[model samples]
Target: MKLTCIAVDDEPLALGLVCSFIEQTPFLELKGRSSSAVEALKLLNDEVIDVIFLDIQMPDLNGIELARVLDARASKPRIVFTTAYNQFALEGYKVDALDYLLKPFNYEEFLRAAQKALNYKELINKPAVAEAKSEDEYLFIKVEYQLVRVALSDILYIEGLKDYVKIWLASAPKPLLSLTSLKALEERLPARRFMRVHRSFIVSLDQINSVTRNTLHIGDINISVGEQYKDAFNGFISKWN
Candidate 1:
């Protein structure tokens, strides 16, 4: 299936180059192009865009913010971050970007990213089986080219380390390593049962044995709640008692 997409970049030359690459790609159909995030948002609302080739640093609303906004939508398009600086790679993963293209990248790199997006699309859009199993109680995590089914109830907490996240599970002797950001995983979790109490930690509310002023004890493990996340964490605690 041909994936319809749009290109967004503040630089005219960069935007033109991405549009050209999209046109040359057999599976990608160019839907639109915009030099501003605001205009891109409007385009997304007006059209059925499947993927977005977005530049991270732009005037007014930046790509990262735009990504967050899009991610909250029910029919969000896949994002591929394009930036000159590699520093925004982590941020790209935060929004669950399919791939990232470093500036000065060739058509080869662009095609690779596009292919990844297509594969991901196929994985998520596959038809669900008619079964009694609770699909909402589990997640399909992509690990080493394979998608592994992980029960949400078996999870103790998630630990973020740069671009990777370690899923500590009650059923496993070792944590399951996955190449994804904590923020991205947090979005997949049921909000009522999971809370991001720290930048690097996402704790299951049911697994939390106790909560100190600034820390939470999950069995023997102690996780410190960040200062920024304290108020929200406390608010979560207050609801229980």
Candidate 2:
């Protein structure tokens, strides 16, 4: 089913970017765009919106405040907060936001977030249908204007930039870039095959060429295990050895 969506950002450029991204996705329909939270409120009252791409910082009523207002309603749309700041993430989750997307996000990341929101809605609205399905073994990621199908087996590792995740592949020389978080990618990957070795890296266990002390080698690439992830990485290594 196609999800009805809306964009709300004080900046015209941000709103336009979101609208453009929504237009590219076949499963998402852009219901409307608003420059402020107040305008969004009026649209919400009249329309049957499934998801909302919201900007955290706005004049008069901010996105978070607007989310609080929406939360009071019996039928509130799933929220995806778009912002330049990462500090508001905790608050975003507190309000039950589906995902927190940083500003300057690409279409691939936007698609991932939108998919997650739709999936969540499906689970809530139809639990039996959601439960009967097997885990997703592949993902279709948008790269530039093209949609690229990525099998989970082909991934070597993933690295997180400020607002983007780079998916390193075993066969491809260049990594696939998507506007997404390492945390989000980790959740999507199978726990038995992928493990977080560092704050910025998630490695495919099948791609490991060698491991020495705190570093792991995936072919010619070397990934270090961060202090926070050291114990878990060591445990995985110990179990495999």
Per-model TM-score, in order, reads 0.62, 0.54
Instruction: Give lDDT per model, in order.
Output: 0.89, 0.86
lDDT of 2 at 209: 89
Worst 10 residues of 2 by lDDT: 139-148
lDDT of 1 by residue, 115-194 (tens): 98888778666666622254668888856433578998999999999879999999988998888889889998889889
- Across residues 201-221, which tens digit of lDDT does each residue of candidate 2 receive? 999998998999899999888
Displacement of the residue 127 alpha carbon in candidate 2, Å:
6.2
Give the lowest summed-lDDT range of ten residues in model 1.
Answer: 127-136
Model 1 residue 15 CA deviation (Å) reads 0.7
